[model samples]
Target chain A: MEEKLVSLPEAIRAHVSDGDCVVLGACLEAAIPFAATYEIIRQGKRGLDVAAPISDTSSDLLIGAGCVGQVTGAWVGNVSSGLGHNYRRAVEHGEPHALKIRDHSNLSFGMALLAAAYGMPYAPVRTLLGSDILTSNPEFRLAENPFSNGGEKTVLVPPLAPDVTILCVQRADVFGNCHFWGSSGVAAEAALAATSVVLLADEVVPPEVIASDPSRVLVPGYRVSAVCHVPAACHPAPMTGRWQRDSAFFDDYHKRTRERGGFLAWLDEWVLGLEDHDAYRTKLGASLEDLRIKGEALSAPANYAAH
Target chain B: MADYSTQELMIVAAAREIRDGEVIFVGMRLPIAAFGVARLTHAPNAVGLFECGIARYEPSAETLYTMADPANQLGAAWATGLLPMMTQLPAGRVDAGFIGGAEIDRFGNINTSYIGDFKAPKVKLPGSGGAADIAASAKRLLAIMNHEKRRLVERVGYITSPGFLDGGDGREKAGLVRGGPAAVITDRAILRPLGDSRELHLTSVHPGHSVEEIREHTGWALKTAPRVDETPPPSPAELDALHRVDHEGHWR
Candidate 1:
């Protein structure tokens, strides 16, 4: 097998390209791969079509930085502070450029991604029926359910196969066997559906450890194109067992990105000026240490006694 | 009875909607806090199904910032991704769903997409997050929002979630299989779809608030229940449970 391990910059440089349909594998939840996202912005990737089933500051930052040409998602916002200021500006005002949006419900979009993962043409769903979501996106088709007797119908959601998916997980091996534990949100499906995957690990462990608990592997090593060892990869967003959601930082982000000038300054100070996650951590100082997981509520070990 | 804000009363009212042993697809904001209150108080056996695919049999140790918050996964019955729980909606596994919106019409059609034109929006609200899916298929839908003219409008600019749609079997005609807009729980009153027209009517008003005030705030010609019932104030026990659920007073 080929060595998949690479630095964060190398991973973004090699796998992610300009005009690529990128899936930021976080669904308004923990383990948002912001380190990789910052690198994508720093590298000046352009015309990128970003897909986040349920987004947050990650998508907004990309849009604000002028990297994103379009966004396909259910929701995009700061979650805590308020709406994504950059997103609102981009869509309503079109300050940077006109952003093409393909709105989808979390379930509908997830089903589309699931269909892609399963190598299916499309997934049929019963939802999105009397809503304008059907009218907004021409790709979604309402088809008669041939299986049902009472003239029932199903909405066929097109498969979403992105060029590359960036997944930030709790741990991964050099071989890119990713292990994640938390409230999950289509990370596994996104990885499988993408043509290639870039795995970002906060703590890169030995292959032996991943093999010991194979059930924990969300995405297998073979599907991964590159693995980047970047601790605090999901900073500001909790990485489950490692850290907590930095709501104060998010609040600052929300405030700073209210205007274009403040937003660019935020990008410069946070992404451009900072060399890497380490420098960003240094700038954050001791406060980052305080956000570490305080108490233990460990899951019971699953016994696998096979000789 | 303890002195509680209308927000607290609303939360309690929303909590009371949850049956003791039903699967609910809980949306963000007030619904999350309401579920917490429900689990901690009356509906201990209720199961909360988040859009992110978390089946929470018990309330989180702390209040949730988002439905997909890590706190939600703690002690969860099951933690999968969107597909599993979302699949439950069509399979008839969900009993009721809680949805919120920026604008909602008398027919209960919700708009969270945009405020103005579809192509060029004056304000582009956060697009439908699982509200549409839940609204379409959940056996019963409960809409929780503030009682304001802009919110309770004559017609929403966009239908992000299907309610009665145009009313009078419109949802069924559009291929929606399940129930639509069971009730609308606002800060001032509880509205339910009445008659075959399915237009929302004022069923019960919270104490200290009159039918006139509710009608004044409503964007449409609000119909009143012949005998309007005053919503019961939050019990001391309910308030205590709510405080513990939202210790930080984030939602309150």
Candidate 2:
């Protein structure tokens, strides 16, 4: 079996080429690829299109670092932390770089990814008929559903296959069998739709442990290009079972990032200055201890002796 | 006597609007609290679904800032994937939903996307996170928002979520099979659509608020209901539940 483990920088460098369209996992902190996101920023990847059903801090920080030129997402807010400063600056003032925004509703965006995963030409969206999204994006078209009640109206959105997708999960075995629970937003679908995937996990367990509970694995190892053992991968966004969201951090971030100078100062100290995840952890210091929490095991390990 | 803050009253009013046993798809921020209040009170059986895949969730005593907060996801019966979870709304299983926005019009069109022009916005708010989907597909859409003319407007600059869509069968014409803005729940009063006209009319003013006050804040030439009633004050039980769900008053 190929060892899928690699450094976060190596994973990003290998799979994510410049100008690639990347969709970060944004199930509101469930599995945010923040470490990978920071690496992408540190590498100074540019002209990338950032997409999410809800682009929270992950997308906002990417925008802040001038790594993305376009955004294909529904919403880009800090969520519980007020508006995204970089997103606002990009949209309102066009600072850092001019942003090209392709609007999508939460369902339409997620469904498009699902369509791609299902290998469908386009997904029939039941909503957005009356919203400005149909008017704004020509790609989103209205087609009458021939099967439903003689020409029932529905919006047909084209499939979205991102160049790359990165997700942070609670655990993954050496071969990239990823396990995530709780509020899993389009992670599985996005994983399938992406041409390349980088899996960031809190820990990489032995392959036997992963095989023991096959049911717990959401993304199969074959689908993943690289797996990086990244603890606290979803920092500002909490990983389920591992940690609760640091509400105070979000509040502080909101205060810091509201202004451009403050935001840049933050970026310099936290993101740009850190060479790797270890450095980032060292900076986190004692707070990392506070973030740790234990939870009950989710699944039973099946015995191979019976088989 | 009800010991209620304006936020508490707002949450209670919004909660009371949700019918019992309705499948309520709740958006984050204020709507989460309203849905929590509903579940604690009259709408216990109502399904509290989030776009992030939490289903049949009961808000914990701990105040969570976002609907996607892990705390909010704790007691969920099943953490279904996004497709299955989000598809529930458009498949038309959703009876009601709670939504919020920056600006709204008389026809109930909402603008949470941008403040000014699309290309060059004056302010960029988070775009739709299942709000438009809920608005388009829910059998009845209850918008929970604060009362202010700037928010409740005559015409929104951008329409992120379509309500009745310029009124009078606009939603029907647009092929939204079910659901329109059933009511706008605000701190001041509850505004219901006027029959088929689709124009919002002041139905009930919250305790200590007036029809004139709701009218003063509404964007259009607001009309009063045939027999507008004073909204019942939040009961102690309701206030207690609200406080428990929103322990920190983050949204409160």
Candidate 3:
């Protein structure tokens, strides 16, 4: 097997191209690929299209950094703080330059990714009938159900295959078999739909460890282009069984990034100024220890004894 | 009856709409809080289906700031990708769903997309996450929002979720197979669509609120039910349940 392990910077540099449509794994607060997102911002990649089905904050940060020009998603905002300041500014005032938005509900967008993974042209859904989302986005169309009566209508969403997908998982092998628990979100479909996969793992386990429980592997090695072992990759965001969400950081981020100046200062302090994720980790320091998962609810071990 | 805050009243009212053993498609913020109350009190067997593809039998082990919070996944009954969980909505498996919007019309048509126009907006609110799907397909939909003239509008700027599109048989004509908005639970009062008109009318008022007060806050000339009962104040047990669910008071 080809050696897929690489440094975070090299993996990002080689796999991610300028203006590539990128999809980040996980929905809202679980296993967000923030390490890779910060790197992309530091690299100053522009005109990129970000797929944010239910953006937690990375999309907002990327937009704040002027890296993203287009966004396709249902929502982008801070869960606790309400609006995404940068995202709101970009759309309402064009502060970070105008952003093109193609709105979709969570199901429609996820189904689009699923369709792409299946190599289908479009996915038919039952939502978005009377909503303005159908009329506004040209990509979503209404059609009569072929097998049903002419009156039966459904919405057809075209496939959306991202150029690259970035995921942060609990563990993976050097050959890139990712194992993660908690809400999967649309990670599997997004990974399968993307042309290239950049996998970020908290631990790079041996191939034997991955083979121990085959069912836990959400994404196979054949689909992954690069595997970078980046501990604490999803800082601020929670990685189930690993750490808890740093609510203070998110609250502080919301407070600090409410305006253009605050956002820029925040971008400089957090992303551009830092050398790498290592420096970022160092800055995090004891807070990492504080946020570490304390309680345990271990799943019963499954038997895999072969005759 | 014990004194209760409007937030507490809203949570209990929303929870009351959910029957025992119902499968609820839970949304973010207040809906999650209400679901927790329902699970702990009236609806013990109620299963919450999150948009992140989690079927939770119990409330989060910890406080949840978001729908996809890691705590929500701790004791999930089933966990999978978003597609499967969301597919259950259109597949007619969901009994009821919860949604909140920036603006909602008398018909319960919600707008969470933009405040002004489709092409341009005065303010860009968070777009429909899974609300459109839930509103369109859930057996019955429950809407929760703050009671204000600006929020309870005559017509929304954009239809992010379908309710009774233009009232009478509107949802059916729109090709929606499931029941539309059954009730709108707010901090002040409960509103439900009435008669063949399907226009939302004041069904009940919370403890100190009156019909005139609700009308003053509503953008449209809201109709009143034949006998508008005062919404019961939250019981001690309900308040306790809510506090336990929202330990941090994030939603409260």
Candidate 4:
């Protein structure tokens, strides 16, 4: 039978099952596929694990909405600006999920996932050995130094292997061949390590174009199970260039989330009211343009010469 | 009196303290400029160790962007082999550490963790990234913060890093007596250890700032030097070095 190519949701639903570990490539309130993540959360799926470098709205939202059972990474922020109640409730109150490790151990996490994908017994990492992060997280244990010559040296780390990986990209082909201009190595590593890969992209370009420029082909067709070309799907929030996160909307969301009664009411308007990114953008009106301006402003300046 | 902008003043203050050949650990944003300024002026041999593992950074005329910026690595010499740069600080190799804080309490306990409440925070910031380690381990910790009422608070919302739990005795308890924060330089004034209390005493005020102004903004009882000296203005050379690295021209 030939392999299938479907939308992001379908691919996720097909691959992801109960008690399956998942890895996602996301950063701080930037570059995440909210549409797919929202669907995963909506299903109330249990045992859905995640290994991400940094957490933002998508990770927090999933954890908040009871989609994630276990998360192994660092940091979390809410869809509503600044509010961390949802995250606290999910982690502290909801399930009391295990924290795999603390501190941003990206290289360690990457190595572990790679080890799993390659069917290795263990992966060595130089991070978290001397720090308290190793001592704090029980899942990670110290191993005797393989290179010890008469000195006491040990390696400490936990193995990480995700069943599936989901990511959104600026451009891709029909097949799951995707391209990311910014910060490609970590994301690519995560995808390559996962058992299955699903990609969501802004637009589907010709395969020939991707093939001609092989360097641009971040992920090959063979690795990806599905490729969904959803323009502005990662909306209401920004997608680097297509759209930017509405700060005023976020401010209002933040205000509402401060109070319990106000939070539920705001959630009803923002989360429940919108069907998808299209609907969310409609409610946002022309403010999306302002968000674009804000995004440009944030990324453009490296340092403030005067204060 | 020195006529320098806030950023320039900070660079000048930070530059004066660094030695000729010292390993200075710098965080993103303002610290980069301070280190660059130091390099350009007083301490030309001063090696800048970025958190992103870039060591001995020598930026071009226009050095904007974060330390993790790919442009920072361009034509840069990597000391990865000699130092194992990433794990050096935790390994106790760094000499001096510089950090910025959102809020600092009377005891110098910083709170970049939570702005209001942890449960439903008003501002969820980038939590302590080696700040505690740097604070605890570095031979000398130099803090650079913009002077504001909100920042110099009586109590921090969250203790991102324990500065001085109680006072001088606190460091002994935390096992960081040998190396810890020595001086805190803000836009308004410079604070150093007062007496046996370990309480930060205002040693000097910036040219335009007054003793009353520092007292008014502080959340705790402000301490002062018996005789306050006006901070010397940034030299023309210092100003040139500072503006050289500011790619955005915001400092210009």
The top-ranked prediction according to DockQ is: 3
TM-scores of the candidates are 0.97, 0.96, 0.97, 0.65
After superposition, candidate 2 runs with Cα above 4 Å error: A295-307, B247-252
Candidate 2 chain A: worst-modelled 10 consecutive residues by lDDT:
A295-304
DockQ by candidate, in order: 0.76, 0.76, 0.79, 0.11
Q: Over the stretch B1-252, how does candidate 2's per-residue lDDT look in tens digits?
A: 546777777778878877888788877666678888888888887778888888865765566666666676677777867778878888889888888888888888888898888877899888887888888888888887878988999888888899988799998888888888888888788888987788888888888887777888887788888989888877888888788778786754
**For candidate 3, lDDT tens digit of each residue in B211-243?**
888899999999998989999887888888988
What is the two-chain DockQ of model 2? 0.76
**A163-194: candidate 3 lDDT, tens digit per residue:** 99899998999999879888888899998899
Tens-digit per-residue lDDT, B140-223, candidate 1:
999988899989999998999999999999998999877899989998999999999999999999998999999999999999
Candidate models: Cα lDDT each: 0.87, 0.83, 0.87, 0.61
- Candidate achieving higher TM-score, 1 or 4: 1
Q: Where does candidate 4 stray beyond 4 Å?
A: A1-4, A17-20, A27-29, A78-83, A88-126, A148-154, A233-253, A289-307, B1-29, B32-252
| TM-scores of chain A across candidates | 0.97, 0.95, 0.98, 0.79
Q: Who wins the lDDT comparison?
A: 3
Better of 1 and 3 by lDDT: 3
DockQ of 1: 0.76
Error of 1 at B47 (Å): 0.8
Q: TM-score (chain A) of candidate 2?
A: 0.95
